[model samples]
Target: MLVSRCKFTGISAPFSVGAFVKHLAVPLSTRLHCALVNAEGGPQSRAVHCPKFQALKSHQKEQLHLYVDALLEWNQRMNLTAVREVGEVMERHVEDSLSIVPPIRDSYLSRCGASCGKISVVDVGSGAGLPGLVLAIAEPDWQVTLVESMRKRCVFLEHAVNLAGVSNVEVVNGRVEDIGNDSCFREHFDVAVARAVAEMRVLAEYCLPLVRVGGLFVAAKGHNPEDEVKNAETAIRSMGASLLQVCPVESHGPYGQRTAIICLKGHPTPRKYPRSPGTPAKEPL
Candidate 1:
């Protein structure tokens, strides 16, 4: 048996390995209640029978369930995501985002070197909060900002965050270009992460400008990204970022190719970055 704490107040419930012992925590919010989860695995485990459920904390497991429920409920009226089936949502959207947790944590460790606290993160073009909302549920200690240009998506994101009982998340309804220059957000985050937002070059511009010097931009993309990386050379360099590594998404179950492109920011992004709203996609650096 092992113990995992609730994100809201750090209240824990114990459960035996390989079986979920249903329990609830001190609930400040409805979603803060606990549920099924297995508490067995190393930091990088490909060992569990269920892939998505492999490494979740107790609260995170329940959080995922609630998040999926809300997504399914809202998706009917709003078309929030193309992934419609429950199983597909688990594998493609939810677990795929969770797969990046290792590298994101490694990046934090690289920056803080054994220190523990919230690392500021931004999810650029977070349509329906694929990785942003999922990351927040899995890593509750990390402060996550969901940046979506579309108003409806922002409203959905805000609801999802509230529904998940996540206090460490904020939703920003604006484009990267506008927000990147605002003093409140410019080059202020420890990490900028995006998935299925845009091509690598365009993503770098939208993401890098929001990352502080020494921060990282982790872009989740489909496999075979050589051309994307090659095309992004100029944009990456101009944004004061360098390719760190491309890690395979191995923990998210057997699926099509998926990779996390990690970029380390070496210096401040040039002031002209993320040029007016659609310029990054139109002009591309």
Candidate 2:
């Protein structure tokens, strides 16, 4: 299980097979092959699974492999994910995103309020489409919009989504706030996702307006998020929203614990929301 955790963490350092099991909680079996250290800087080491994560889930393993291959090949010409290697992509990008699936799905269901099965999703500030692409690949039934304002990143996202052969994913070149106000997009999605974008207050403005009254805005962030959340209270309340939960994510790879702040809209957002392009960044609320 410890090795499983390391697989999720994407540990990069190398070590002798015996020393690995001694220090870490992973199973020590003659079948296990090699040990690698954490790439993100830590003495914490990880033993490579003998058969790798592929063996565990043979059915969909090939699809995951294909996605990583696409990401790496694309990164060479156009930037996609920060972690360039295959192992890092699987653990850090894949598992890390999947860890939040439960909340995202639940939040989607709550928004649908009886439509519990599948729903549409909008990934705001989808740089290289982190959780958005991952979620689209994992749940093909749901439609996902990859909203990005940067032209180059949008090009990369479009290429990546097309190359992945993921019919459910669409890349939109525009700011979240601008998209949220569009007549076609206003209150159009069941769930909205943002990862490492702006602070909570600013994110609320960017995301809340896009979701229907009962929909959710899920903000993915690093370990400590209290100050960001506290700072967003006014924006959250004023927007007819409330904090649902601050879900702590147990890191599966080199990174440590993460957090996903779930905010729910209690009523329709005021028409003034999103306040011109850089307004949220200039003044949070």
Clashes per candidate (backbone, < 3 Å) = 0, 10
Task: List model 2 lDDT by residue over 118-202, tens digit each.
Answer: 7788898877677798788777778888876665566556555655567787777665656666766778887888876777888
Among the numbered candidates, top lDDT falls to 1
Off by over 4 Å in 2: 1-60, 108-112, 276-285
Lowest summed lDDT over 10 consecutive residues: which window, candidate 2? Answer: 1-10
> What's the CA error at residue 216 for candidate 1, in Å?
0.4
For every model shown, what is its TM-score relative to the native structure?
0.78, 0.74
| Model 2, global lDDT | 0.66
- Per-candidate Cα RMSD to the true structure, in Å, reads 11.1, 13.4
Q: Write the per-residue lDDT of candidate 1 for residues 1-285, one digit (tens) a residue.
A: 001111112222332322311121212333212211222343222222346565677777767767776676666667577765555666667777888888788766775354436788899888878789888887778888888766555656666677778888887766677777776788899899988778888888888989988888999877788899999989999999899888777645445767889999999988875552454332110
Which ranges of candidate 1 are over 4 A from the true structure? 1-49, 111-116, 251-254, 276-285
